[model samples]
Target: MLNKFTTKIVSLSTLNNYSFIIPTYQRPYVWGEEQIKKLLDDVLLSFTTNKESIYYISTFLTKEVGDKAELIDGQQRFTTLWLIALVLSEMTSNNSEISTFLKKGDELRLSFEIRDEIKNYLKALLKKESTSKFLNEHFIKKHPYLENIAEALSTIKGYFLQLSEDYNLNEFGNYIYTNVKLVKNTTPTNTDLNKLFTTINSAGIQLEQTDIIKARLLNLIKDEKIKFSRIWESCENMNNYFERNVRQAFPNWKSFNFKKPFDFNDNLFQHNEDVIVTNPKDIFSIDDLLEHDYETVNINTDIKSNQTEEINENEVYCRSIINFSQLLLHTYRIHLFKEGKTDFPEEFHSKNCIAIFNEMIKRNNTEEIKRFFKLLWKVRFVFDIYIIKWVTNIENKTEQLELMNINSNTDGYYSRTKYEPSSNLMLQSMLYFTGDYLRQYWLTPYLNYLLQDFDNVAPTNNSHLEYLEKMDNIISTRGGKSEKELSFEYLKTNEFTQQRLDIEYFNMHLGTGFKHYWFQKLEYILWKNWKDREEKNFKNYRITSRNSVEHIYPQNPENRIQHPEIENKHLHCFGNLVLLSVAQNSEYSNKSVSVKKSMFGEKKHTYDTLKSFYIFQSNQWTPKEIEEHKSEMINLLKMHYEKTFF
Candidate 1:
């Protein structure tokens, strides 16, 4: 069986039924901040460097017993990249070349089930059915956050448009279509890309079983022979169990780890005062259960597998996390269902997940699933921490003790639980301990909560109790903030997770720190600000586009740019260039830079303070001047820091 094939980049209209299979058991789509930033940066860079439409195709192999490729990896990268494409489409839809690609891409691609899934997901994300709708839905005309991202992409797209004005994009597209490149593997071979992706992403996080369940659900969604109703019902017990027991009864419980144990304090419930912790049985309507149409969800057993082989452990781990996420979601749904509300869907948003996975399922681009895994891993522990705190708080409660004394040693609170490592390797043990304690901290209490609803009976059906001893062993080694700090450290070292974080924290916040870098890189403002080349005059005005932090003050003169411009003597002083936008700074042109500061009252001081700080920090400043300005800079920074931190 061949796992690799190479093909040319063809017209969007030509690629038909060449399914992009994301396995049901693949990890959920997630991208770290940095990886996302890099991807966006790459696209932007490409617009500056690569002239023709650059197409890249990545491929992966599954060890699972199927040909259907569930998005085991690369979901976030795909989604974000697609988003960039969408933005490009919107920007150039008016221009013939870009419009041709955008409209054609939409028309040709979105008709595919996978593409529709992505479109619907994007709509949900944008909170609008269409791009035009997004433009109108908000009072600001264009949502600033989204608009910033779009503009970055739009600028790059425009750069390309101008570059290709003479060359026909359609002609280039035709040439590329005729000569596609694939991974070029004939027999099944594990691509190093997938392996590297798995290693980089698998550090602190492991995919969950719930991810697998969602994959199964998606498979069911695509199956025609099996009624969706039957599939729904088959999953009802599982769904209802999660919802009633987890999402609603324990609103904070989202992930499953067996080490960090949980304990339920039922006595905390006060008939006259406190919130009632209801049972799963009470929450799920019996009428709905009895009348629930299972006929709609039964997926065909013989449904074609997009996967051609068995999925490896990495793939399994990935799918499991997605399944786990769905489980949390269902649990939340159950919470809502208890209140007689239909707040969310039951199908696990398969279309959206699948679509994202499809766009990102490439050999070199496993960053998406890696992100999902990290979050899945982090969230699991976060929930665990919450449960532990919840249980500890309950045990110490005076009101609860009046009803029952449920300490950590009590039946539901199994303090005597044993521990065993699945692997004896030190690293493995640490991972186990980390995962186990974290799991116990959250899962045990969840079970206890369920048991409390069933007359304080401990969990008999759940696997959690059986593993209590192993959890106990791992918990013995549990340290304080050390464990959490270590987890974060592990995450930081993880390339995929880190990259996804960059996208989340940096690229997404482009108007924040990221745009500053852009301004520096482009140097558009320096040209506009400085007009004269100098040597003889020794002009009191200092002019330099040395890529220094945009300073508010001039170097040579102590008088601020805010002081009235005194002709050539005070030209290009600190006040004029300090608060200028990047473009303005570039435009000042080093010529006569004499400009008076605006009398904006309090705002002026803020600008002055900021400008003063920059000047003080300049490496070129004399030691004496730096010392003089240090306290002022410190004060300004201190004030800002206090407000930000405290």
Candidate 2:
């Protein structure tokens, strides 16, 4: 049956016989960061470790539809492979073979048999047009597959930026074209994919791709096999490697060896309170105004790029090491996502990278391995720098650099706003949402904003605080649906737990980080107005990890005289909550309301927030007061929504 019709191992380069088409049954392009990275890692490993001159990725099951072949089971991999090919084509401009398949647009076609709106949406992306209005106004509601396409596009472009110039990109491109092979499988006459879906679903996965990736990465180190293997295994608890000092050490990426293990005791990296320790020699080379030029001030200042690198001189080397991983999703998000939200798969994001050993015994030439590692490290470095200080890769030709003049001037925090969000406000907002507990409603829009404004060559008209406004509209107008309700509506997850909820209760149901997110956003918005008039210790008031929801009415009533207002009912509700430091919460825990107010005065710096400051106006503690405070806070939230959307 396999031989009767047609089957051939076709390299992506010389392939031109049949056009590939994605059917409507393929649904949304759901290959997320995990799937995307896994595919890239798998292919890279195959190239680096496998000895096969032609590495067959998988078989594409299809039946001919006119001149084009209707893709049945292989749509996801095909889409990803095509995107990777496009990236490589740009990387290797001189190579005609890599670009030919794509330049001849008919070779890879999108035949959305059911969802017609998506055809245009994809065309817009390919044309490099501003898809915001189409995405916002029509496609979102009209096309069900919109989210997947948007995500895939965002993920691909973001990863492409991570490819640094240290690698032989041209050669890698050639490898992708000349070596990445696929088998074309065909059945008889034209048939609806919906009818064939059951048969395709039963077909098993062909390759254990990630396992191969592990063998390849580990194979980098030939010496100190046992020691490094142990370290690699332990590190494989799986996390992205964070080499903070490599920016300084390897000013050039072409030379870093993935195989050579770094000693944890080495003074190269000094992690001080989860921050990368940088020296005078690390960041600056400026010779002008505001101490340093704009170019010298790292794109991402959240790393304390401009601040003094004052850390423990006699610091222990125990907590400073970062183990490298094949799945660099964290760094990938850092590059692409303005507010890196967590939704990536656990194994893809969490596990340690397995290095290629002998079964990994595949044979990639030294130059190929070196080049692959260069791409890997480039992705890591670009993403790390993006998260810390938004710097584009100077070596990456794909990174379109801005023509700028930085001779003497240097005071662009992108800071200093009057009422609206300045460049600093947007930048801060992006830095702000890097927590794991962000809601999907907000994550979707936030990713959209970053891809549009931050990654663009020039900022757009609606690219400022208005972007925040649009995002707020997107999130706040989750149509007052609860997480369960929204999940059911969109994701088709109709569990027994799913129920209806109003906006107020929905607010209560938000994640801890998301609650903190809003409280901090409000704090910053109000702080900008209050920054003037010389407020003591309040000038630098920004959200810290220590700032937590402080229950004014304590969770547990004291052993002493109990108050009716401080009941178990009100303890966990938003009515009793305000932002306070961990130290302050501990200090005021179970204390009388009057005593807590007195402590609040002493620790005024902690209570500098408008939300907390509003609480101080009422001296007494009663159920009525708590209810009123809750009402006021709710109004503030409403006001924030009003300001953002309208």
Candidate 3:
């Protein structure tokens, strides 16, 4: 029966030929704005980055029932794609595209089992009978699952609307319809559907390529394999600090202290020579590790002990921006750059990590492999201290990108001190939100910068901040340079200079089509130079992941007569636009400028960008006010550019 299963790769256009049905046992649609936006952005990026490239979205496991295919997996992604088709159909206003691609005559290509409300809601949206207000009021409240679909629809619509000015909508729509693809795996009819579903749901996570690489590398090192494996495990635990990971990994070792939390030295695992260490029972050799099936192997049994340090419940949870695979790639890039290899790839994708390292291993010696692992340890130490993490606030449960300064007490216990937000955190947060969430290109060069003087002494917070600010300017102004070229330039020279911003060349009226980076960058500049009596209002401000570009003077206001003085041409301009979260954008939807200002005043803390707050400071929004605000903001940006780049 397993041999009878069939699989084929199909483009979105080809996928449209078959109809799909979600089983009654399937989970409800749970993807929110973040997931939906990511899909939209990823597809858009694929189209823009390489239009000819066939982007494989994901694999879908299904079982054929008569003419319809029952989706066993990949429903979330497929549903999102269907919603995208709906959005494109509405934008183009061509029912044929929908009929041919997403629907069979008037019937949707996809349907839910025992879920009529959702099916009806989708039909209403397709027929143009559903409005944003209608979704919020009627269907969403009754059918809770519809909320995600509604939000997804809004997110898709808003994403396209925002990028309309910058991208070719027709071309993008066509690319999504034709270029995007999925792999469909059809199970045999004889297969037990219930058993298959149970197995899939109860399955454990598959072994990562990193795990394979670890095994392969450890097989080569006859001596100190356990110690190196421990080091690799410590670096893999990115959530906790490096020192804490080291302590957890080496539980029996007493008197452990890093020169500093940020600094790494050779004596990290070295303990008192007088202490007798007992090796764990039944240790497996590299050959045994390589030959055994990872699923059946009890790899943790050797390390597991009752004396192991328990995790502290009160400790702040900090999430690393990049995963272990990405960190390994970054560390490997730095290692190659240091070894006088200038052609290493700058872009990072976890899927390609094994291949990237495989090429490296084939060319380098076993000793070099050991060195790479050691460098990974050192890199992670600096990364934890210097990088901005999504630190969770215990009380509010809100996460913010923060770089907490580590303070060591006289007794050698490290505590995270609440340091005031510095330019380092602000600039990193700005770069973080502005760049690709998956491919953080800035870290490669920035991590290399930290590694340059790492052995002598760790850099002070002020100097580190200055270096990052300069890197930010270079990244912002490096108009057409490839990421590899930019990384090489950053590595090869001390003088980091790039193209300067020409204020005249920038379209102040780009509105939704404007690059989000500029808005986020301006926010950083405003926050850095803030000195108003309302300092308390602006002090806690940090740039977050915001996709919606809001207009101060609403494009379609509820009260039409509220802002008649504002001209249509100035409505989408930089002066009127501010980057905001999707929820906030929905909250401020189509309100009058005065009402929006009143809403801003009502909040105790201002979550809006400082630039937006500045605009709201004016009582009435008029063409005169817009022009005045535009001039001031442009000058501010230009001045900062000059100060940083010149």
Say which candidate scores most in TM-score.
3
Q: How far is candidate 1 from the true structure (C-alpha RMSD, Å)?
A: 22.4
State, as a TM-score between 0 and 1, how close model 1 is to the true structure.
0.24
Order candidates by lDDT, high to low: 3, 2, 1
Clashing pairs in 3: none
Which is better, 1 or 3, measured by TM-score? 3
Tens-digit lDDT string for candidate 1 (1-646): 5354322333322333332343333443344322344343333333334445353434332222243333334444433444444544443443323223232323322212333343443444334344444433342223343433333333334333432444544443333332222222122334333433343343232233434443444343333212222222222222111112232222222332223322322232112213232111212221222234322222222212122332223210001112333434434333333334343321223223443333223322233333332233333332322121101123344110001111232222111111211111111222222232212122322322332243332223234332332332233223443322332222222221211111122112111112222222112122212244241222111121122223333333434443333332222222223333322333332322123122212232132222432343344343334334434433432332233221
Pick out the ten consecutive residues of candidate 1 with the lowest summed lDDT: 398-407
Q: Tens digit of lDDT per residue, candidate 3, span 186-212?
A: 887766666666555544345678877
Instruction: Estimate the Cα RMSD of every predicted model relative to the unseen true structure.
Output: 22.4, 25.4, 5.2
Error of 1 at 34 (Å): 9.2
The list of candidate 2 runs beyond 4 A from truth reads: 1-327, 330-348, 352-434, 437-452, 455-502, 506-533, 546-549, 554-572, 579-581, 604-610, 643-646
**lDDT of model 2 at position 166:** 32
Worst 10 residues of 3 by lDDT: 272-281
Off by over 4 Å in 1: 1-14, 18-57, 60-69, 80-167, 171-200, 203-646
Q: Which whole-number lDDT from 0 to 100 does residue 530 have in model 2?
A: 53
Give all TM-scores, in the order shown.
0.24, 0.36, 0.86
lDDT for 236 in candidate 1 is: 28
